[model samples]
Target chain A: MTSSRPRPATIGDIARRAGVSTAAVSYVLNDAPGGARIPEETRERVRAAADEMGYVPGAGARSLRTGARDLVLYVRSDAAQGPLASEFLHGLSRALRGLGYTLMQYGAERDRGLEAARAWAALRPAAVLADDDRLTRAGVELLAKGGVPVVGLGSDPERARGTGLSTLVMDHRAIGRAAGRHLAGRGYRDLAAVLPAGPPLRAMGGERVEGVREAAAEAGAAVRVHDMAYSPESAAEVVAGWREEGLPRGVFGYNDEFSGLLLGALLDAGVRVPEEVGLVGADDLVLCRMLRPALSSVRMDGESSSATALRIAEVIAGGAEVHLSPWTPVPVRRAT
Target chain B: MTSSRPRPATIGDIARRAGVSTAAVSYVLNDAPGGARIPEETRERVRAAADEMGYVPGAGARSLRTGARDLVLYVRSDAAQGPLASEFLHGLSRALRGLGYTLMQYGAERDRGLEAARAWAALRPAAVLADDDRLTRAGVELLAKGGVPVVGLGSDPERARGTGLSTLVMDHRAIGRAAGRHLAGRGYRDLAAVLPAGPPLRAMGGERVEGVREAAAEAGAAVRVHDMAYSPESAAEVVAGWREEGLPRGVFGYNDEFSGLLLGALLDAGVRVPEEVGLVGADDLVLCRMLRPALSSVRMDGESSSATALRIAEVIAGGAEVHLSPWTPVPVRRAT
Candidate 1:
């Protein structure tokens, strides 16, 4: 591997190594229109040459020539919120970075302020990935108006209609049903559902809460609905003040972060779980399992966004618009 | 608020808004002596105009005018092998971004890759934020010879004296001692520490493992160590097969992620924490408190990275060098 032999192999070097011209190399590597005219033997030789010479193309250069970065944005309504958002971000960043695309986070929740979007818009991202339903309509419009494609990560597909936003919805209703049905099956009658205080999650949390009510009703348990702001202290305060409401034997947190918070507070207040009060959380992040008693919740597959990113790139590259479906959640049981 | 307001609120806009010439506005804004004398009343008016118009300078534009980006590269020996590296990075990025400088990450951990100083040189960052002790003398010489200022982010501040790299000394040894001492205070003599596995984390995990051994010795506990791979399933499998070693009353996971894994696995095996076995995990992430019993361990001042990033920016902007002591960790306890 002498420097003279092309210290870092370029596409042209690969073509030269394969006894072909740069145009043929572009045809083979870029999926250029004229690639069909290139002989199969020559294409194989170019590929083999590239492999042998470790000819990984410069991503920036490719983006310039192809007019695509293959990048995706994961927009949070706000940057400062939730372990799930952060986890999704960490994984998505790591995953996308691994796949050779930049993960630009667009915050619907801007810690950096509103001009942040205008600034981010300058990056000319290939697509907009938003989670908020209301924002999905507005964001799809916001970005589409700016000539950027949009995809909804964990949003309701049906609700996103007419916005031209492709969907990768996370079925929060199914998650609530699983949790509610799980607790109802544990033979509990009196039950309470805890939801997020924010409107962004009420749709999902409310759906889940409704599911719990429906499931508990079917199991013949009188259901009580409790809207508690998430936070260990807040959850504890709610439960502490509500002892007179006849403490329900089961509680479902809006998500794993809240579930874990409530679980600890309940245990600290000397309320037992499953034995006295069962807990069900959503998303089932890795941390859920890290808790001492373990956390059980509805597992939403995480790979959908990555897949959506891939599909979004396809769409932007002038491929046919492929419809994506909403995600379903499954029940996972751990200690609690 | 009209677009056609007398001024648009740029430097030029400020001059127009204040009814002053651009040269007078520039002199007032820069606090420079006017080439042609400008009155103090004019300066005050210029300042008021800038404020009313809500004009602020961009960091990049400032850097361009000043001949430096104020950016720093927190170069790593290997990101995969590090525990503190991620924390260091998270803190550094949060800090640098807040301070108007970009933070870049790079690794030279593949052996003699330290001689890979060319990557560091290519970026021409204001400073190379790195582990001074980890880089070979040749590597450090190569970077320093190129006139690139370096800042060390590790336990070996003294090592920088030999290499001319300014230091941010972090005490991994102290982190171990703190965890070990806390567990010992809980009256548990048999201690087991879960170290991270993999070549990237080998050095880091070993360092913490050493720190634990030192603390355990002082605490009078016979310590046995375990190396677990980077996955929850791996931690579970290790715990599942731990009958041969016998259960320790107190255990410290290398970090919160691993600690969470251990907690989950132990709970699944029906081990009662503190009652049968006490558990402690480091990094006071939200999940720790969210857990049923809640995890207890050391709390590193991760939020302090902002200060560190600001200092690095100063160094890049030709500010005097800084030396930071290793951040202290506080013992945090919950029910367990």
Candidate 2:
């Protein structure tokens, strides 16, 4: 994929400058312990010379030699979305960009999971970061069979080697627990969770609702549930009808975007926040702090989407498998 | 690259199901308009079959065979960005995703102008949506040279393409003029535009400042320009120091994010909205509605980023170049 750009300075230049051989330069730079028996004095000279001359090794050249590059893949299912989940994507994209790697979003496209498998095989990515863990075992197997490493984000990691896909489950139930814990502590007896209508959001939303319900139930607090369409119009309609259809004293919005929309409608109707209705959102965007009276929300932060992408690129590059760490939700106290 | 799994239906499948040739299906879908003369009866039957079979023609195959697919490229240049430009991308993303085409954010690394050209070439995109009209003409020429249709989003098309790339200018200066006239009419003698510190925002910010100046100039009102970083801490510092510095009676924030941030600080410092200091923002978002004393701002819908992608797709699909209608900024007069 690279063109023949010629005559760039190789490690030979640094070795010559350091009065050492190329082997010494490589050992010191790569930190290949025991790769060479060069004296410490020689290694120091090589490092100083390399730094002085601004000598740098090309990643492409290194990859060609070792058949491995530090690249991470953020493999994701095709998006069947309508600007929904954009904040997550933007966050991931910005974060991944910070980590430094090419990030690509992939999906099999409408019940073509196996075809997605075929596409994944052709790409031969080093590591897989499947945002959606629902990928079939067969999908995982095809990639593993190709000797590609994999890690499932928000998916089951236990089946990684079996299908060659490792999982990093996002504890949706934990988000619910956090939401329940916060609102209940605020001394609001009546509680409800407003969820958006969709397969993806439904699963995550259900976990959150269950957590709220379980916590509220244990506290002997009343729990109600409402479904939403993930739009300003739909949210307004839902909020407008809430008084007549059983308005809870406190509500946990499935996410920040949804919660913000719901809160807007409640305010439009002259309802007092934390008084008539306590509100909670997720995702700490600039707008959250900008909101009048501000918004109380759940903060979910950690290695961003870009970092995930860089890791995937590495797995694809070096053909190495990785264990994963996930960032979970934590409650941020702000005005209701 | 596909595995043993049966591939999904292609144009070939549609042709066979209709007992016609692949060319027939293409002709019917393309309508080739005045080019083809097929019986309405056959057309109806073909349409019905396609719908019943749930056939969405393959993007890859169509691009390969026809030299184009229904996909447009919205390139996010690293060199040029405007105030609240994300609102445009967000709107565009939704519009195009609704029409079905992935919205790719083209990042031009350190390579600048030609870097975007190289990236777009490798992707083999159907068309180009260049946000930065200032990219060297050679880069624009390179994209056109590759047979890729080109369009401009919020850029001066006439200047960028000269004769090739179609333009969709946002005309933000008009927004500035409107804002200036509104503030002057409200009896504010001094006007200030709090601009974000950056290269990308510089050009548009300058244009807005000019427009505001012209309006203030005509109305015989004094006007001033203030530059500050868009971060909360920086914006707060600017506002906090305003008292000793002789604050402007009316402040026009560069965009919603900046305005929103500055507004929050003003409120926190006990500065009243419209009473002590009148304020205005641009690119209305959902949060603007939620801001207490509701935000009085300009709304420039601009071209939807996703729709830009769809249009480029259509051009690649052999449709005429798109004539994007710029979104006008309207004053949403609420509490402010």
Candidate 3:
């Protein structure tokens, strides 16, 4: 077999086939501003030739001329693959597509700050959406300087006050407060908040613990903070420690998946749920209903992805001073 | 606040700052051949100026010049988020990065055939990887015409025999065969294979059912096939039907997630697992161990993603006639 294969049809190839100039072919294909002046007959010829040759407009060439691709880069964080996160992404993708933009998820979660900004700038995306504390002030500025607007979802909206970065505060504290209040309403005087010990998860975890502490104070109760790795063994060990150190009346895991693991461990250790200890989790996953006792969780009542996409469109259209707390975490009671 | 922000530093800006010609700056930055002949002092000055200006190479410009991006596009399937799939993707990403390539996952699962090929071609990826029966002959040919190689993972490797396409056959039939043999070995003369009824999942489902039928015939047994939607209600309905019409001696769900759902519904319906009906599932998930009585499953003993990446690298480097059956499904016996 010969290694030689036909190269992609270029504007020149289309022009030659259509018996027109390259500029004429470009005008017909790209729909440039002055394309109205071109004859419809010529336009039809160019289009026909392009279709026959299977011509696709080069994204790279278009980006070179316009200095930005019609692409929205999403620098995904480590936890962005969770069920709730997946829903947001799928919706966001569809919303952005409706607005004539493609959402490209970048899986280089470890690349943070200015290093990440540089890599993103190389692609010349129209906008970038990031979650949590992945982007620093300098990173935001770097992207801004590269003609790319940024929309952030994190605990701190004030961090972008002067950086021209639009922020949607996730309010992890609100999630914790909701969980704590639910437990307190159930007549629990002693409470605990369990969170991941990893550095990447610590910032949000800290805010949640603070919310729990605040709720505990309002209820005239005491709250303890416990940190553990994301593993079944770690959950079992935590449950074992609780068994020895006297279990709190109520406890909330960082999220549903982690809490589900704790529920499993607690059951294995012969601990009676609700009667002895009430449990809660946040980011209400479908698994909550499927669990034996049905885990109680907090739902983030954020605006639809369509709404967020419109806001992003506004940011790109030179509308700044955007501050949105899209999420309002609310308690969702189940058996647990 | 002023709407005017600093644009990204360009090669021309670096040239001006370093008091050098544009060509000299290009040679220093792009490291073009013959750059070694330039004086060390001049190179240092250019590098220092570039660092101070925060100039990053434009991916679009580079792609335009070379007519291809150092991107390996993976058009993800609906099932690409499964636990096993995630592991494969993560490992593939790392391996591709080691080979100086970036793996970009395009989440447009609905677009298939020549339409998807045209879209992927616009980005000018070096190669494309797809799963199952997504791409058609025209799609593969269109990509080949544009010098973009394709590597597919699906049931039919012969489908790409003369299309300059590389395929890694995922034998769904083998998965069913393993489950059937496991049930047959347990002395179950009547067996059943359950799968999703949705069109997207039916092709692989059909292949698995055929394999089960083959195994049942060899063992002098009989096999029945059933289809259910991906819902707890659907699973309950299926299980309820078994109670009405005599139950099969053994059953297997298409994969772990589906099978796990079946296991839950079975236990809820007062079905005695293994005793009354032996059960099996594929893609042994972590949920298998966490479930009550520990659900039995089959593990896909496929080559590591690193190995597959190497094979892909070989394909990109001009080696042809590649055929790989990366999976050999084997039974994993548990309490269920």
Candidate 4:
């Protein structure tokens, strides 16, 4: 079955077919300076032979020889789900492509820290942009030793500073704070925060809850935290429990999708939004505006972060050091 | 700055530091059968030297020598957005990983045609899974010539047969047919189909509309198609127009996200759901059960499709020919 498929033509095959030396074929194919010295007849023959044979220079071979690559690998600790992460990745891919680099998203093994780093290092990518948890101290050192620039996304800048990795700090706490302040200003004294129940979302959920706590304390408001899975059934159960115990008029769900789920569950349970429960979510998604009462949210500037990450990649590719401040989340108010 | 960063250790560096032959280092590092002849003291010394120096094998050099890669590149014509695509990819990634393969998602240039294929071919991936539109005939031929198996997802199987590329037919039209039949059975005579406005979604939307048309024609029902962008503003405008014209009671939005948007828009306009408008969506997303009226959807077996794709990929990797039937879409009924 393998023989049924045509084999890729190699430089050796092209040279033999063109009746030229391997060096001449390489020169012609790469358009090297020495190619000018080759006879015009020989060059044309080489070109025609290459075209007929469908020859594509192997990226692996070229990278090994040049010690550089046009590939930018983004390694995530887990799969990126939901609309906000998808949009951010799309924006980042476009930004990197505009700079003449291909963005490849790779899902790394969660527990095999050093082994995963070794696998990624083997790719010889020009740069590796990763989620904070994807790379440990040893993993970062291994990649740096392999001459690959590493950038940490959604990580602490101070920790990244010691490892020489450029960090793009995503302040989930700031998002929580924004949502908390917005709900408090709306005169909602009793508040509740919905945290997603998953290992991947645990860190983020904790930071958000802390931020909400800080703001709630400042506003002299009482706050309760709820751990819920990202499923309709879980949301309905929470709504049912809340209805029985009296619901908090102002609540902050993790993101728009979760917030939308909570909102729907409330409406399904015969609860009126805003009048009975005003809700806020983060990552001001398109769904926010489409919801019944509309949803208020905290907007993270993904475009700015993507642009900054690209710029930092450029500097790192040039063997330069760069530092940037963490991004701040802004509140977007709607009907909710 | 490049000088400031440490360099990775090579085989020669390990050999010299450990006072062993390069062949001995290779045998020890690769854990070759020949390592049994080497003394235990020398093996331990070599191992310590390699680890202390942080030596990692170069993937580029390895691929160039072995003529095979561990990469299965999944190139989407556009970004994977929303819950359905994301979930499918996540499942595919996990399945592939379990089979000892890494799945890399690449967003290809929408209009680059053959040039894009050349870029992908240069990478020398073991397999390429792409949308039907991403690869032209020439592109498919090029990849096959390079000894890379190609798989087309959500494409015409007949066309795939001609190209010798394994295909996983998603049957979007079947999804539409299912939705149409469900809506018609519910006794809704007037039906409207919402199609998203974008190049990536254009093909899929058309197929779904065609399926709805087929079912509507059989039922002698009137069907209208609406072109709307995936935004709240667009949805609100659609609702406003519908209200002015005395809207259709049954609407088949492209997917759950769009259906949710339309449902919210209708509710915000003081329209009662189900009582005034019956809605159906596809993908049976989590949002379905959360909505006030609980959206009815076509449940696409993404997990089954993903599993089938992985199985086919494994067969292709082993130089075997395998054919499977297209997946069927099942309609799931809920409140709406």
List clashing residue pairs in candidate 4.
none
The candidate maximizing TM-score is 4
lDDT of 2 by residue, B55-110 (tens): 54434434445643334556554542332555455455556556654454533334
- lDDT (tens digit, per residue) of candidate 4 on A223-265: 8899988888888888988988889979999888789899888
- Candidate 4 regions exceeding 4 Å error are A1-8, A19-21, A33-37, A109-111, A302-306, A318-326, B1-49, B64-67, B302-306, B318-326
Reference-based lDDT, residue B198, model 2: 79
Model 1, residue B105: distance off in Å is: 8.9
Count of clashes in candidate 2: 27
Best candidate, DockQ-wise?
4
Q: Each model's TM-score, in the order given?
A: 0.66, 0.67, 0.86, 0.92
lDDT (tens digit, per residue) of candidate 3 on B154-271: 7377766876888877788988898888888889998888878976678888888888888899999998777888787888888888888888888978877677677768878888
Instruction: Evaluate residue B239 in candidate 4 and report its C-alpha lDDT on the 0 to 100 scale.
Output: 92
Tell me how far the alpha carbon of residue B220 in candidate 1 is from the true structure, in angstroms, after superposition.
Answer: 4.6
Q: Which of 1 and 3 is ahead in TM-score?
A: 3
Number of backbone collisions per candidate: 9, 27, 0, 0
**Model 3 clashing residue pairs (backbone):** none
Show the lowest summed lDDT stretch of 10 residues, model 2 chain B.
B1-10
Cα lDDT, all candidates: 0.65, 0.65, 0.79, 0.80
Q: What value does the lDDT take at residue B108 in candidate 2?
A: 37
**Candidate 1 residue-wise lDDT, A1-336, digit = tens:** 321211234577777789989988988977788789888889899988865654545333454466555556555552244545554455545555555554544333322222443333333556656665425243344455445566656656576666566666556666777788887777777777887787767667888877777777678877677677756778887778657566788777878777777777777888777677778788877766676566788787645556645555565554233456536677788765
